[model samples]
Target: MGPIIGMSPDKKAETPGKQEERVGLRGVSGGPGTLPEAEYGAASPLATSLDRGSGGSEDEELTNLNWLHENLLQNFTLGGAQPSASPLFDIEGDPGGPLNASLSSSSQRDSLKSKPPLSFSLLIYMAIEQSPSKSLPVKDIYGWILQHFPYFSSAPTGWKNSVRHNLSLNKCFRKVERSLGKVNGKGSLWCVDPEYRPNLIQALKKQHLPAAHAFCTPPASPPRASSPPRHLFLQGCSLQESDIDAATAMMLLNSAPGHHHANPCDPDSPLDLSRPDSVLVSSDPKQDHNYSSMALQRCSSRSSSSSLSSLDEGGPSPGHTRSRTRPRRAGSEGFHSDEDSDLGDDRARPQPSQHRSSPLSSSVKRPVGKRARREVTAKPELDEELKEAAGSLLHLAGIRTSMELNKHSAKSKKLNRK
Candidate 1:
């Protein structure tokens, strides 16, 4: 047959030669115009062989193709090459379809990832605010967070414990019991406190999430009456200049006259004006002299009482003496006669004056010993029983002395008889 129907004479002639060349280069057993399996591996052998035959000087093309061919065979045989999963390349005129879809999906994912997680308080506030009756059970709150935020879904189970902790500890959250018929859960439903709702809504708005606006609507406040101008009110109540002056004058006239001198009752007054002599109630010289005399008399009475107290505390001063009766002689007829003579002599003796030394003079002469200091500082009042005991002790001492003297005289009389 003269050249095949679709093949030109040159191609027909060259095809066998090209096939022989390919077979020889690849070192594979195959028929004329057949592709070798070793050259292309899993790739279409026909397409690769056609591309290899299409261009360039044989030596250069063969060198480049051989290198590419070896790499392709290695990758395909080892199962290292992977095909694109996207279908955009296979579709005829819509290459951008899968690419656009991928870009949009990636952008959406990035946006979700970029948003920072909401705080625990904010999360609870959001859940409560979005509830149908403005309250949700703890389980429902947990469900809401997992549903809205994908991050929490894969997070550790400890976050649920955190949610429960926030709900119980936050003062802004309040627990409301379900109605008897409506109760479906074990725990009470949680709601945001009304007083804190406005604050929570404001905080949510600051987050700038569009979803925040839907649940952040606060109730409108009642309109308030406008107050009158302060200046106008003051003008209506203001007093006239003439009336003010008249009021001031009347106040002065009604007030008591002020004393030019310091008041006697004032503790801050430097002088002791409480004394009659210090207070000049009248301008009379005779009344002033009388007040001075009365003040002097008061001073003298106080001094006398002080002096009596000092004398009682210190006993009699050195300038004074106590009178005592002489003890009677024992075992002699002459004793009775001598006792009368001694008593007469004691009575005839001059008594010392009962003079009290000044307090300054007594203190100067006081002894420095502990007992002496104690006696000087002792209270002035002496108990009557104590005075009687002291007197009895003195009397006993005198009787003992006299008995000793009587014994001595008896011994002397015995010696003279010997």
Candidate 2:
């Protein structure tokens, strides 16, 4: 059989149909390094170090579209081209300017004035397509939309700032963490999941002219291959994700660093855990546990990182996500957030980063903290809090299990915690 993700390279192979390469956008999960979650619709962060994009080689053309985006926008005025036949493809066939008919004259413009000219539509698009901006910061699919529509050029002056803020308020955008780096003396960290975006392009097209224009925008790369829906997609498949069983899970834990885990999340490449037959078991029990403990501690410390590694678990419920983003306009009978609403935090996907620097092995045994011990365990009294917390965490109960326990002992640990 041909080599699957995480499997050993195949010298001899057999398959019925001609295998098609999986089409993946460059930054589907986050950017360079990201883990899909399992809570919503994402895969577990533990199963494998999942990249943000679909399957491709390390050196694919879309690997880093940063240079391409930069040159296309900043250098366009300078008329710069890299001695290629075409630099920026004539986006949207716009001969005049980018924006179409303006709302400048109508009451619509006046009403929109209070609301930022920011396109919530674009930000959501970035998250959905898992595309990034020029900086490779969650690679917002916005640029692709901009390139596709090109009409926004004539929109307004403060449009850019409004757009940034629109993205800030977006729960999905916030839930997924990005690397914190400086851009033009300001913060430039970001991450997103295109599959989790509110509504699909076709749906957007049915709503607004501008939104539709932006949504339908496809890739600008010259067509060298015949394919429909030319834009790439990072899919969440059951067979692919569920294939990571317990034994394979153990292998992944072993391979990771004990005190510090780092997975080379190449979105362009196949998922390492998804195909385990090829995995080289290099786990050192001593180090793997230590490494994972520290990593989990670090993750637990970050409030915004709740969904850092579970996008797949939070699967693509585009309809649900769309409902969460209620229309501000009156008479809009869409979903409004409440206890029973599916629009709650459950719709949020985990943050992605530019790189997966370190992930503590979940399989590691941590030094029981004193507080954890005092609150719960008996023999490990010195580290009660840590022990209790660990037990509750392992058991899926909240830290309350650790905090509320009056009597602490190993014997009662299971019954009391459960």
Candidate 3:
């Protein structure tokens, strides 16, 4: 055999086209065409080592891409090279080229390392627990994570979407609607589930924090147990111990004066207890007793006056006055209904003296009695009086007309006879 013909005549006719095709398909199918080994002789040791290193790197990138495809995009097959899963591969341009492959692999590796695989639920729980109210909204949660966790702040986009997704899907957090009084655009409140709180705390402690040693070490000494109970005050006035429960206190805190309470049985009937015009009973035991005594004395006096007024109105018989003056029997102390009814009648009767004595009563309108109320309005009585006056005037006018008619008729008859 004289010399084996290597280059085909058809390929030789279009060498430039062939070279371009080879260059384009270098990484895929086959590598770039090389000079005959006989003419180039054996490759140098340094060159061989460099080539081996590059080949090894390419193999490693392919391995990584395969792993990502399996784990992250399970539906994607390596053969098809789907562009939809762009995070794993760039299917459009040089899918296996070192530049694109290395970049993607390093990025994926760094992200995997940077994100410490901490549970998102745990992160949310920490943010809320550390918040002043032990509650936060979704946007606030995002802010807190970015502020606290450097990894999150440095992370690429889509993290916020992840946060929203986790919040909606996770059962460990509860979304409560804001009160009707809250301003618009102020979103609902997010609270950690009580059942999940313990688990989240444990997870936080177990978290391998590099900064924990610097910040969260245990105290050297135990806290003092002999400390006295403390009291709260505002501008020197000691706040009274509230008789209401926590929920009621919260409702009162959020609500403004004159507005209905947050929850009620009906639209018209409000649940508000501390009205602006109402007189709040003192909570102090000593002051409360004194007030009760004063109120009892006032009621007795009012009742006596009411009986006298009723007697004067119609001049009822002596027996009726005696019956009205009879004091309540002393044996009915234990029953609520008997005592309530007895007090109710005295309270129902209007007394100018009691109303004048109460300072708060000046602002609070005291209820009037049935008779006095009608007198103050006087609509029906005024109408009746006007009607009677008009009738009398009309009767007088009719008699005057009859007298004139009789005189005129007598005069006309005399003239006719003449």
Candidate 4:
């Protein structure tokens, strides 16, 4: 037993092949000093892919390993109770890896649970909190879930029934009967109890996500399309002060001179001096002519033919007829006719042949209604037939007058006899 020349005397010489086998065994079994490939792949997909490349440089491998160590150690806890084990290389370093796996699986199970299974009461409360009115009908809660939470948009029909069930059963949510006068009359309004808001918000946050995402701001109402002006009734037509001023100026210019006593251009008057004078003209010739004709008719009918003829023969000279006047009947000036007088006793005795003349015969002169020192205007011509008709009428008038006188005499005689 003297030392063999080719091998150390410690046990049987450790053969390279046996050592390789042992190393392979250690890799498969995840020995105390080494990590298994399956778990390495599971923990870091990047590391697994890197390891698959057989030709990677040493520096590149070392850099990648550093990155993995820094990033993973920062984010994940080793929870396996080993402080110095390499985060990327050690396997048994995690004694509690199985417990962690179980925890992760259980959490996965929890995540797999149906979207935090919104209890009916919780759903109603969330809906009311997010509603613009902070109150909603139970039916609206169903709709709100569909709108904000896409999970419910494609959900089965049972969710709405569940919601109604929860509202009915939950003491945390309140149902307010819509006032009778409300415009939306059919359904009761649903409200979350204010006291429960804190709990509801916490629960919602726990179930859904960050408060910001869970309670999203309602999309800004699409800016109401700017409405057209309400009082767009008129067309382009418009009135201006200048137009009114011009019209007023025309009116004042056309008004009578007497009406112009208050100077129209005065600040108090509507018209201004700037307006043209040509707008005003004298009275219409035709109107003056018609008025003169009317006056002639009135005067001619009351005057005797003798006075008319005198005027027609020679118009009065302005100087001699300085007091040119209209003719007036005596009775018209506060005098009554003898014909209107009661019979006197002297009427029984035969009186002088003083035939009672009509008050029209005794006429005194009065000034004409209007004084224009013009010659008498020529009368309108009468047709031959008209002259004849006028003569016949006068003759008939004389005969009627005589008959009336005779009747009066007979009546007087009869009275005398009585």
- TM-score: which candidate is best? 1
Model 4 clash tally, residue pairs: 0
TM-score between model 3 and native? 0.24
| Cα TM-score per model | 0.25, 0.24, 0.24, 0.23
What is candidate 3's local distance difference test score?
Answer: 0.30
Per-candidate local distance difference test: 0.30, 0.24, 0.30, 0.29
Q: Candidate 3 on 277-360: residue-level lDDT in tens?
A: 111222233332221222222322333343432212211122232222323222111101111132345533444565434654
Model 2, runs deviating above 4 Å: 1-148, 172-185, 194-418
- Per-residue CA lDDT of model 1 for 1-418, tens digit only, reads 1111123223333222232222211222221211123322322221122122223333222222232222221222111111111111111122222222321232223212211223466667655544434466787777655433333444456668978877654534656645521366567677664333323332332222221111122115321112101010000111222221222121111111121111111112111111222111222222222222122223222333444322122221222212223221111111011112323454234433222134332222222232242233222232222233333433332343234335545755898799
Candidate 1 residue pairs in clash (backbone atoms < 3 Å): none
| lDDT tens per residue, model 4, 79-102 | 111212322222223322332232
The C-alpha stretches of model 4 lying farther than 4 A from their native spots are 1-117, 180-182, 205-418
Q: Of the pair 3 and 4, which is ahead by TM-score?
A: 3
Q: After TM-score superposition, what is the CA distance of residue 20 in candidate 3 from its true location, in Å?
A: 43
